[model samples]
Target chain A: MDERERINRLRWRCTRRAMLEMDLLLGEFLERIFPTLGPAQADAFIILADMEDLELWPLINGSRECTDSVQAEVVALLRDVRVK
Target chain B: MSNSSIPVRKFDAVIVGAGGSGLRAAIQLSEGGLKTAVLSKVFPTRSHTVAAQGGVSASLGNSEEDHWHWHMYDTVKGSDWLGDQDAIEYMCRMAPEVVVELEHFGMPFDRTDEGKIYQRPFGGHMSNFGEKPVRRACAAADRTGHAMLHALYQRNVRANTQFFVEWMALDLIRDESGQVLGVIALEMETGEVVAFHAKATIFATGGAGRIYYSSTNAFINTGDGLGMAARAGIALEDMEFWQFHPTGVAGAGVLITEGVRGEGGILRNSDNERFMERYAPNAKDLASRDVVSRAMVTEINEGRGCGPNKDFVLLDITHLDPATIMKRLPGIREISIQFAGIDPIQAPIPVVPTCHYQMGGIPTNYKGQVVAADGVPVKGFYAAGEVACASVHGANRLGTNSLLDLLVFGKSSGDSVIEDLATGKVAHQDLPENFAERTLARLHRLNTQTGGSDVNETRLELQRTMQKHCGVFRFKDMLAEGVAKIVEIEKAVARTEIKDKSQVWNTARVEALELDNLIEVAKATLVSAEARKESRGAHVRDDAPDTAENPNGRDDANWHKHTLWQREGSSLSYKPVTMTPLTVETIALKTRSY
Candidate 1:
């Protein structure tokens, strides 16, 4: 494989693992703290979680190089966890 | 003490460290219905015990033919006859039970298809008095210490032992009668000093590897408990003999677990020739740590080393199956990648010698009672772990003996303390003024000193000096010069100051305190290294070329006694080693070979 292709593969591996762990931790936290949030809020949380995972997936997995939007999204997700 | 002025806490027993020994002791103490508290400077998982990559020694039912007697013989021989026979015998007899107990506690030891704990052959472990090598090391792949510590911590959580994390013990509080009453500790988060009173105190603080800069120790292995004990007038036993692991990542000083070699990784020079064959023909890659380390250094000195700089040899594991490497050495690969920035699967990882473990510390009996400076038993004061030497590992420690020492003695120390607590009455005394004053003086000096040198720079200099002079090979003149340089560094450390002065989350202050401990322990090591005249085990003397002295005289007799150093106001006093209770018949001295 080309260097770029190799790097992309390695990045994908990293991002996939990071996103998976982050989602698991957040899901566990939400379940523990607020298990009875309204359906719309819970739906919003799920969509946001998916979006956050997608953003983290690229950077951490190294499929796509890190970008300001991706970094901001990850930071927001982390901050949300802290606030909760 | 008023509640406003004194931050008072109480426990049935307070364990001063959170490494293997301390965690083991806490598990026992709490399980036995005592309220135990483990005070540590870092998270229990981050302790240096996690750095131990080899296995714990035990003669389990793995081979069905293994016995504890063979294990004891290997231990005695490994220690080069300086190990106390009584302690060695006690440890050996208890090894099987300890191993079984760890398995019961879910240690995750590698198992055979027959559901038996898998055992591996480590250096110097033999059968029938050096006839053939034996599989005595009970391991969990290569990360045995990691597995063992994780198991102990898990079991400890189940026992509900209170963990006082990130709190550094500043001083042991003793009454006017010299009985250890409690300790005063500073919380790392707030810099708040609190006085903790307990019925008994156990120092399970690990080794002083950070005293030398280029060591395989974690940043936290500062010998704090040993320094505190020494300052409290405790005589550190065999303070001179430090073990340098033969295979560490060159320049970085990260340990490449002996398990690699135990699993068939060979050491080779730049010419791709097996080098250990020249030094230890029979043992080859499995010679004792002291011999292997010296051989590696000699190769480098003779310009047979690998790389353009000719600094290190190659630890070749590329020939091993990928599946085997992934399963047994996951952590090793991760570390090599993180620190050395190399992929071990394709390249030979560069390796060298690094300061690993201390073979000396607070003097204790088999029961883990702390023997005072004057040979009197200190009441309510106990020691286990690397901080306390029950003399199991005398002149040199074998590859797997450290974990064994922690488990065997950790259990014994707890049991002995429980016995004392059951029978003896609690003697209460007021905290000494001098204790607080001395600790405050140190804090003040570090906090206020605005000039001189950075603590980090001075610490780095100390490590460089030790790795250069007192490492692998040594001579009297070189040792003397090393000691003199260390003394000068100690002075520089005294004047050394920290840059960050904030009381909140002040890691700099903690580093300064740790550096102070490192300096005191380093002084002890240098002084003791210079006092010993003959080469034996890890403490080799290049000036005294021959191991033999006085041709008509008995061999190993002059080197029979252990070297003891006592800190005496900027100088050290030497004393004779105790050699009694010789058990299982003393083996004759022979040339130590693989």
Candidate 2:
């Protein structure tokens, strides 16, 4: 329920993925991503975490656009970080 | 003051790894009224033993006429006579008793129509001394290893065995008198290094198949025990022979158990021809692992391979009834679907031989005591499972024999420990003041080092090198080159460092430690493989062809003995194989053609 605990939980979920490419993209850029999260991006991060790698990778990969306004803000932030 | 910071724990016995063998040994040690500690990097059930599909070998003769003698014969022939006969006889004779005991411990064994434990034919399990295939593998469907681990762990819990889960052991501790004390381990949660002093130390750390680029082994099978032993100047026997299971799902390296073939699955080439008939006439799809693996590679090399790249063959179980596949090999079907994206009942699974098991490790006697190169037992040190070479498997291991080796030798080590304890002479020796120095130094290096070779990249290079050079077929110059390449890789391993330095639950730190162990295995394999000129068991070289006079190119005159690789000076020595059995006549060697 606390903000710090929720952010830590989101970090754990983001870093661990079945596909290595997703793990590398999310996990390798982990230190950089967490420190720079804006308030709006922080609140909407769970929406991205909820999506499976099969659905999420393409969205971050520029194949599709985020439909929801708050979700698009988080996706735009992630799209800036280069995948390893 | 320095020693005060590190906690020291003492037990009557400490067993590394909680696979089938470790749990089996723990049952005896704890139940026999001795304090026991079983340490594993993973949870007890999640160990590689859980990945064992197929079954355990037992000559209960449940399905048809069978005898332990025939099992011993097939084992000797299957081993290509590299396995010590005494150990082979001991394991075979003890197989029935162990399997039955496991059943009594609530193991879920499949039953025959008469309500007897069901058995299936596995590769190299023949009846009447290689006359015909026999149903000798006692299975719980295809999840035999999983069932066995659960059954054994449940028993261990009831026996009140102490478990150290998520703990990684770093080094084997031996007193100044050359008597083994115990190991210095790291508690993953606290990152505290502790010395687990014990009267007896049993290493059941299993095999290191991950040294190869593609392997069927779980990620945790990193030869931890072998590494610690080797670093402590212990000799590793028969390091050249590694088995390639005939059916790993191509590209994914997930194992499709040999049990599939035992249940009437067939391997076919691009032309839909059952090509094993040409390599092994009598056994065909049910030939020993090495023969089957080689035949598949040869088929692929000659361009008879299936799939788009023509790099793999096909394992077809379409002919088997769907009901039977569902009943007997449910796990195999699940793996085929999950890994290869093909269901066996609908289509053939793409298959290639991938590194599966190490047929060698720390040399031990039938009693599970780790032996020196001169045949003397190392004081208070014991080993079982894939980490110990009782030399029963010799050059090539049979399918179900692995589970048998673990259970029999696991109990053997435990019984030996209890008897040794009963003598009242197995006292705890004084630990050296600097017992934890080597362990601390390694940990300190990992913690402090910042700029160095990345751990994962170095590991990938090591695996790719092993896969390229020491594969199904070997060449003289190629193996020599591989040896040189591995020597360079070892240097890279030494320089490799981890970036993650957090104190709690550091998996990256664990991986770096495992890499040190993997390099030892990779070096031993390549070095021993290059020196041995003969083709025996899984170690077949193209230069030494199986000619009419040569008969599988086994140079018995020159290379019949076991190879002992030493860490000091990176040297290799030879030891004679025990030809006499515990009881009955020894099985003589002949031209081994399936």
Candidate 3:
């Protein structure tokens, strides 16, 4: 699939969290943060997508920070987008 | 063609709920060459099973020297000696195999440094029969159930098992000879009513935890299978015993898994004292759910509760390493911050006892065949998971055993169905002419009924009444009053009207239908709880005095047998517990204390 199709699929997955709180947070992140990412960052976004909402939610909440630089940057982006 | 003349769809086997158990069974049946159909009220992934945060129990001996026999002993004791030994032995023995099967199916189980499955200690899991806490819970970082359900769903998809998402089963269709024909269900998207005619029917529709106002169950866990079985003249076994998890987030009632305690989390009161150490000195924070819940409630009652209202206690994990918290209990951290707005790594999460699991359900044998009060199997009918009382978890289920029960019994039932089908003995029983009429009429009544009482109001009233009377603690006067009040609420439920006229994707209509089941479960729980004179396991009664032998005030002499609730005139009966296992010495009953 092309980049647009991949992003759309990722958006669909974001809305399907097991917990409703994660659903809202991830949905917001996709809508606001997806358009600003380059190809490598999009790949990093997919890596973050692979993690369960349980892991991803905390990274964005700043309660637990991600060690990986790519994941750390995505988490920062998500937090930034949430504040905006 | 008119909608009334909808043709029936045929399958070799039909499974309800599509959660872990239903999907597991569907995988087996489809792989066995049976045309299987799984009908679920929500998308398969969105089932209530996804909310389970702890690991599945297995004596894999990965983290410690553990054995199934020792696990069996803890389970029997945890159940307060009410669980059938034969089924307990079977489940404990199959735990390792099934957990391994899940691993082989690409379930993301956490691993130790040796590359074997990582095991965590859970409440009531011991090594050498009450020696010490044993590492038996095979985890996937507090998302074991999520991984297990996804793995099973994937396997079912591979096996080509047909799925009917967003379809709610209205009633069980039975022939005149009392054999299960299939079920009549409502397709939520189009509001079309359809019939599934199968040679065999399985009810894996989970528990009725939603009956209680403060529960960890999802909105969909209305005990639909139990309601259908009871309405179809099947006796619900042991409906009174409800497990109350001690660590639900205070106000929200969302679950904080027992894995938290397993990973060294402690329960503290308002005075900053570790209170479980007072109740259970040996097990401390890792006592069985019932023991811990009672301790928490007692602390709150004694004016030691935390928070402004003093209604809840604190679960402290701030002492644990931040890396460990993030790696092992990430979900709990997320849940705490999201639900309670408190992060466990920084501050303690406020929690209280919440209704978690139902030990009683549609009465079934160890083989998963639904049995009547006479101990005879209902032909072509089966049950598994939380909906079925295979009598494995007896009065209080040990943590992680719920997921294990789903896998072991789910697969057993599927195998039994395949064997029965291979014999060509249980052919498709013909449905009566008006089989679908009753179910259709129920839908019609809900679809067209004007205002009498709001659906949400009636449901909330039932929840409040249940929470008030039938809670962690019970007394004679309170239980009797609860029974009477529930009966009055039944009328309120009957008079409840569904104002949503649209048939397509009408959520109001769905809630209305679900309330029908919830009321049945609530009534059964209250009535059965009131009738049981003694406190056993989760059914702790304040009025019942402690016996010399039984420290918990459990009167096993009169109430040792399971209580069976039959819907015909709403009566009760008793069935003997199968104490003898297939090939092991009976674990003799003893006064249970942590």
Candidate 4:
């Protein structure tokens, strides 16, 4: 698979609890993951496993990064974890 | 301070100074049905014991045929015949069991393919009359002490032992007749003094390496227990002999564990010559710490040192295979990368000697019981680890013997204290008013003084003076001068004022108190160093070059005693060394080589 497709596949498997463990904001994990993988990939993988939602396709095909409303909800979730 | 008004916190045993020994002792005591409380100035995980990166010595008979007798002989010889042979034998015999116990506690020691713990060769560890090097040091991938400490802490947590973190013990609480009780501790967060009463107390507070400005010691290691014991009229044994590890990262003085040399790292100067071959032709790069440290300084003094400043030489490990370096020395790699911004795989590490471990502390017997100045056991008070001199390490500790000493004595002290507590005849005493008043006055003085100097600046001056004068090599004139300078610094310390007087999380008060401890220990160290004239172990005398030049003729007859330093008001006094209960034949002085 291409780098973006591989990242999307990894993000679909991500969980909120995993995101907290990696100490990353939720949308940031998706943004960094969707691009070519680097140091942030390991962090995103850990965080994705922690969230309650475990489905793959919605995250894979979702255009949330392009939409303002969906992006705000994802950012809000991360902000909550950051405060914790 | 009142008998009725004084608050009491009870434990079956209370362990002061939660280093390797304290943590290990707490685990044993709690498991044996004693309610134990471990008290430390830092988090238990950050104890100076964690700074030890080499390994613990034990004769596991790995890589070669080895026995406890061989280990004992090497220890006695490494100690330069100053060690009490009886205590040395006890430790050697117990070393195997201690390592096994640590393994049982889940310390991740490096293992051989046969699934047994791996042993490494350390400096001065030899076999068959120093004929061949032996594998005696049981290690865990260059972070043995770190792994051992983590294991002990985990075990302590499993046992549910109570811990009072960030509480500094000011003084030993004793009665009018001087029977030991507990301690007066200041809560770091609230600055409140609380009394922790126990049937028995153990001081595992590590060493006073910070007395020297540049040392391999952690910042928090300020000789707290040693100072407290000395101030309370207990004599510090062999305070003169401070071990300077040879291969510290030069300018920073961070320790590059002896394991580096064990793994074939070489020491070289600007000449690119292996200089140790001239000093110790046989052991070469792996000579005893005192010999190697002195040699390094001498090379620098002779203008053979590396770099522009010429203060340090190179510890080249780049020749070692990358896989071995990564697997066996992951922690060393991390420290070098984080602190010095260098990778050992590509370049040589800058290295020099730093004041490492104290060979002296509150004088104790082999049982780890704190003996008074009169040679009587102080009831309800025990000591272990680097703070207590069971005389196992003697004038100089061996490379891996320190961790062995901590674990063996720590467990023994726990068993002894628990046995003492089982009698249930311990008397509770009221905390004296003067004790609290003295501590309060010191804190008040720090808060109220208008300031003759900044505490940090004075501390830096003290460290620099110690590093220059009383370090690796010493002379009577230099030590005498160092003593005078330290005394002046002590006066300056008294006049020093706290800049941050706010009560909430006030570290300034802690630093001020720690300075008092440091100064007291520093005085004891200088005084003891001045008294010892002969070249023995870590305490080297330049003017009195050898025992042949000394007034005392015989080595075994004269120099076998411990140097005891007493704090008499503002003055210092000394007593003869104790060399008793000798079982094995004393090893006579020979030319010590690599």
Give the alpha carbon lDDT tens digit for every residue of B66-175 in model 3: 99999999999988888999999999999999889988888999889999998889878998999999999888886777888899999988999999987889899887
lDDT of 1 by residue, B171-286 (tens): 77777777887777888667788878888889998888877755767556789888788777677788778888788877666668788988888999988989999999999998
B567-587: candidate 4 lDDT, tens digit per residue: 776444444444433565545
Compute the lDDT for candidate 2.
0.84
What does TM-score give for chain A of every model?
Answer: 0.35, 0.73, 0.79, 0.28
Between the candidate structures 2 and 4, which one is better when assessed by DockQ?
2
Candidate 3 CAPRI classification by DockQ: incorrect
For model 3 chain B, the run of ten residues with the poorest summed lDDT: B499-508
CA shift of B465, model 2, Å? 0.9
Query: Which segments of model 2 are wrong by more than 4 Å?
Result: A1-84, B1-4, B256-292, B295-351
lDDT of 2 by residue, B52-133 (tens): 6779998999889999999999999988999999999989999999999999999999998898998999878999999999
Q: Per-residue lDDT for A19-80 in model 2, tens only?
A: 33344445534557756777776666666765655568667655688878877876766656
Q: RMSD of each candidate?
A: 9.6, 7.7, 6.0, 10.5
Let me know the DockQ for model 1.
0.04
Candidates in descending TM-score order:
3, 2, 1, 4
Q: What is the DockQ of candidate 3?
A: 0.11
Q: At residue B535, what lDDT does model 2 achieve?
A: 97
Q: Which stretches of model 4 miss by more than 4 angstroms? A: A1-84, B1-7, B256-292, B299-351, B546-557, B569-594
Total backbone collisions for each predicted model:
7, 0, 0, 13
Model 4 TM = 0.78
